[model samples]
Target: MRCVVMFSIRMDMRVILFLTLFTGLCIADSKGNLALNGMAVQSSLGHPQGDAQHAVDGNRDSDYKKESCTITKTEFNPWWRVDLGNVYSVSNVTITNRGDCCKDRLRGAQIRIGNKLDNNGNNNELAATILTAPNGTQTFSFESVNGRYVNIFLPGNDEILTLCEVEVFAVIDTPSYICGPRNLALGATAVQSSILSGAGAQRAVDGNRNSLFSLGSCSHTNADRDPWWRVDLGEKYKVTRVSITNIGDGSAARINGAQIRIGNSLENNGNNNELAVTVVSIPLGETKTFQFQPIKGRYVNIVIPGRNEYLHMCEVEVFSD
Candidate 1:
């Protein structure tokens, strides 16, 4: 009987150890190349077959004739950029140089990352500079930098840029409050400035984060100056955070410069409440969470001031800590 009990205990320990190792391996394998989901563009096209999208099509074919590489026309400061849709803590970038010919074209190229659109993101933070062209593929590792744009700029007169593939890896930060209290905005009374077609204000708080507008799950407002959306939490409570999801189909930049306010007052349509934050940008089909010092309020408002543009929101979530 003693021997049987010891054997059972040992089996259980072995099973627990195996599960721990398996779970770690699965998490490590889940991080994939982010460049595959990005939108690629270049300064100018050189070869008829060298579309900018070719470099990120998940192919590393070195032969340019096979149409798996990108080429820019001979010009000063040629650049290629990929919009990653959402901001990420980029850890490393890998570049595959053309092996068939003219590998030297990639020399002196600079890799930059940031959210700024100035100069087509070429003026962002420099990650690395390619002094020597790689014979095949080269990986450049750096301290994690946060950005939504990744650009490759070649600085020289009469120089053409060619790349077979570009891969970006990000350091995914685990959420701390994944399981928390119930959302305060769910089933709450929501009102917007104006309705566009069948889209109403209540859809933003329906507990659905579907980003597609065609799915009838989003709220839309007509093009009006300073369009606003507000949700009443029944009574005032300390608000801890707000999460807003933007439309996925298009015009995701319409939410830029929007303001979040909280208070019980309906003055100026709750637009005069305590300011929570100013949204700079939220990538398409993505949710951005803003956490600030707890503010007490029953009405939470999101207004895009100083603008005459449509307002669309796929989801809006409010939480109290």
Candidate 2:
């Protein structure tokens, strides 16, 4: 009986050890410093050794002389930014201050994150503000903030921005379904209300997402009230989503407020079909996807109603479940 009890105790200890190690491994894998894989830029270079890339070079050397820091030229609203390539649910950002000298220069800097490039991303959502100089390395932890760009801006006249290291940690947010393959709109027939300068409706279904209007791959309609475009898939399909690419060069807001309708009815030029989604905005030269419950339709219409404006579309793609 004593020997059996000892064996049971040993087995329980081994199980506990295994669980602890497995949990540690999962936590480590889920979080990593994303700044290393991102692209870094600053308002201006102050020193040759103080390139923006140095701050994210996986180095924490706080001494500017060591060349592991970034220094921007003394100017108004000095700033630095990093592009994470894709949007993420960022959890925390770690910043290492210049330990060698002039740590006070970092005071009053703001950390911002978002997808907008307006004012060089300075208009993004604010995450934190440095109230005092960090002694060395300080971390600002916050709730999951979704964005693709992280910016550090110092708002003042003749203020300089310096950073030794910047680290970002995040988790991947997976979507319900991945889009690719089996597109029904590629081989469909497309038509528009009116053509402008030979910009026909078929260009929107050419399977090319080239956003440049001068490239002749986009569809254009003359300025008119309630201009519309439609696509026929030859057969009824349960469309799960529609992806629209907006003009890249300029005037992307023209596509805003457009309604996406899907149904078999051609009444009102299919503009009265079941509404799928309304386009709010698509960034310049970017694609915006609208996903919803499956809607059965043979005709897909994009109509901008109650206004007189040109309808421009770089590409339109339809997907089914």
Candidate 3:
């Protein structure tokens, strides 16, 4: 696939490339970044943070820290900017401006995306401008604006260009979306690895989501937007092991088949596609447990593709020696 980098600034005035690592979005700050001084706007602007506007009234530059994007500035006043890593096929950007209204710093914020150009009629123009009202949180999605960099012009009506969220996508001919939560660094092992501690003893607590934002398999059947279950081995866990317990879904759920997948199913790495270690054929019953020779892998994703009646699952406790 294509590589996608974020916030990569070029100092030597050379075009850089960004790459996507697996199904994760990683912004590696190796080459650093640059500022885009477009429009007649001031460099970077200030947005009303906790008390920047209040601090201005209180005469406190010490209390306010202004974050700005130099490359992308407003057509009017103090602007905001987003220094992307490399040029991408950007559709649009979603900006959640600060919400406090008492300060006159922010309410309506304007933003745009463009690239720096050399001589000649390169044009270098991407897409149309995106403007927003002085209030509310909205997601503005647009067409593919190809460029090496993007400028998120911040509005400095108040104090600083205060923004809450930022999201950019690589849009070309592909009809796909990027999945994330990027940090899936742990490998896997032969010994048993624990994804959670005492907080998630039987039921599913928090802190077990993979790169896809899907939580690892927990005993709860009513998990958020999840129908299947999975476990990342973290390393290669080789065990002719067995035993699974702490499961029940009342009568509203039932699932079958005890199959396992080694890696991420979204972007196939071709590592463990056909390597399903079938433990047992599970039926829709009160409980199902199995014990057998297990294949060692970086992941062990158990799935119930077909919902027989409802979502059925239990806490699986694997045994090894």
Candidate 4:
């Protein structure tokens, strides 16, 4: 009887130890509605009484008869959009239509997500379409798209674009590369292949996301083939993510197609290192976060390969574990 009790106690201890280790390894995917409130919104017109800020105020009281949004009387492809402050891997978008009337006004509304501001961001990539749901909330889900701007456009003449609430659900990631708790890219040495004007490479590592890599705040390459920027972390570490902030107000296109690479290699401008993520595009003044399974490296590089296009960087941050 004594031996059996001792064995039972030992087994319980083993089980507890196993459970604790498993819990430590599991990291929950932080989930929440990213577009809850306090996002910048804009609209084409302010007549019929509607302000763009009403769209993201988390109010679902969509009574068109009441004083809600500044509505315009039906025009050509009238659009409304919200700037989410940063680029996000969007999962879905929920729109609240006017419960009182004009729910059909949202028919054929194209939901676009991208960085392009041409045509009031209507020219960007289409993620989903707004279905007609009268006096109710409708959620449109896409296959995990990425963007900083979310626009709703009714592509027709004399169409009213009325929105009560536009809730965007995105995978919000902690900024591991910025000046915050999980920041690992702080105070690193940055260098670029060329410098344009007074913009040097160190501005990227200066921990300021406001500096534009375009005119006078970031590093730029002049007449250089495959302009590249790199950061040295001084010591070898296992990198987990890399985030880049693009210039605001329609300058994000400058960093499109840039490749992020990480490794200990210095040959060929560190282009031969482990490939991180190819930046398809980033929205204006938004940070695009790229994740990896923790690659070990001391050098990180962002290069616009095979193109003579100038390299621009407002900020570049690297995260390591």
Best by lDDT: 1
Task: Quote the RMSD, in angstroms, for model 2.
Answer: 13.4
lDDT of 2 by residue, 1-321 (tens): 000101011343532211122101111112356667356778899989999888888888898999999999999999999866446677688999999999999999999988776677899999999999888999988777777689999999999899999988664333411111345786479999999999999999875566888867789999989999999989888888999999988698999999999999999999999999999989988988999998999999999999998999988988775
Listed per model in order, the count of residue pairs whose N, CA or C atoms clash below 3 Å is 0, 0, 43, 7
- Pairs that clash in candidate 1: none
The C-alpha local distance difference test score for the whole of candidate 2 amounts to 0.81
Look at candidate 4 and give me any clashing residue pairs. Answer: 47-71, 49-69, 49-70, 50-69, 50-70, 50-71, 51-70
> How much is 318 displaced in model 3, in angstroms?
48
Summarize candidate 4's per-residue lDDT along 24-90 as a digit string, tens digits: 1111112234454433445455564587767776667777556554365567878877755446677
lDDT of 2 at 198: 94
lDDT against the true structure, each candidate: 0.81, 0.81, 0.36, 0.68
Q: Arrange candidates by lDDT, highest first: which order?
A: 1, 2, 4, 3
Badly placed stretches (over 4 Å) of model 3 are 1-42, 45-76, 102-109, 117-136, 154-160, 172-321
Candidate 3 similarity to native, TM-score: 0.30
